[model samples]
Target: MIAVVQRVYEASVKVDGEIIGSIGNGLLVFLCVENRDTDDKVTYMSEKILNLRIFEDNNGKMSKSLQDINGDMLIISQFTLAGDCSKGRRPDFTEAAKPDAAKETYNKFIEDVSSKINGNTAIGIFGADMKVSLINDGPVTMIIKR
Candidate 1:
């Protein structure tokens, strides 16, 4: 599994001109499931994301986790994280999980995050054509893979 985590003041996802999910003062996570991903990956990623000390402390140090700040999360499925562009001009997604498996793992990942964050999370529809908008906070972004 791979995730691009971005700290955001606010974020939202829209599908067919309708808002599907949104969050405030939290993280916007673009998650991808690879063919080799498992439940352990989901567990580890959730814990790591929730406990990541990206938020600033009172002294202006980046020392507070999302849980410490009571922040929300907006999770979006993005299989392109597994895309391989090493060859030719086009990217290949052969390493990404099949639709069914990817969807299952993605859902499980969201469930795990929700469980850890006390349900303060929203998710975009799996395999949907989504439009995501965000006010990135501190421009802080990190990518994690497992």
Candidate 2:
């Protein structure tokens, strides 16, 4: 499992000129499921992203977790995260999970986070052509993998 998490003031996803999911004062997550990913990996990655202390506190220190600030979450499936371009001119996606398996894990991840955050969680369609927009707060981004 891999996730590119970005702190954002606002974010949204659009499909076919229609807005699908959006959020405010939250984290925008681009996630990818690898062939070797397990249920345990999903659980761990969700927990880590949720509790990451990247948000700032009153003293202007990055000490607040998303849970502490009650922030929203926008999760999107991006299989290209598993793409490897180290060898050839073309990128290889051999490590990416098959569509069926990837969707299952993606749903599990969304379910896990939604269960924790309730109405604050938003998601892009699993296999749709999604257009995502966001105002990246602090330009703070993290690449999390397990």
Report the number of the highest-lDDT candidate. 2
List runs of model 1 lying over 4 Å from the truth: none
lDDT of 2 by residue, 68-138 (tens): 89999999999999999999799999999999999999999999999887339999999899999999999
Give me candidate 2's TM-score against the actual structure: 0.98
Provide the overall lDDT of each model, using Cα atoms, as 2-decimal numbers. 0.94, 0.95
Q: Residue 14 of model 2: what lDDT?
A: 98
RMSD of each: 0.8, 0.9
* Candidate 1 lDDT trough over 10 residues, lowest sum: 111-120
Error of 1 at 139 (Å): 0.3
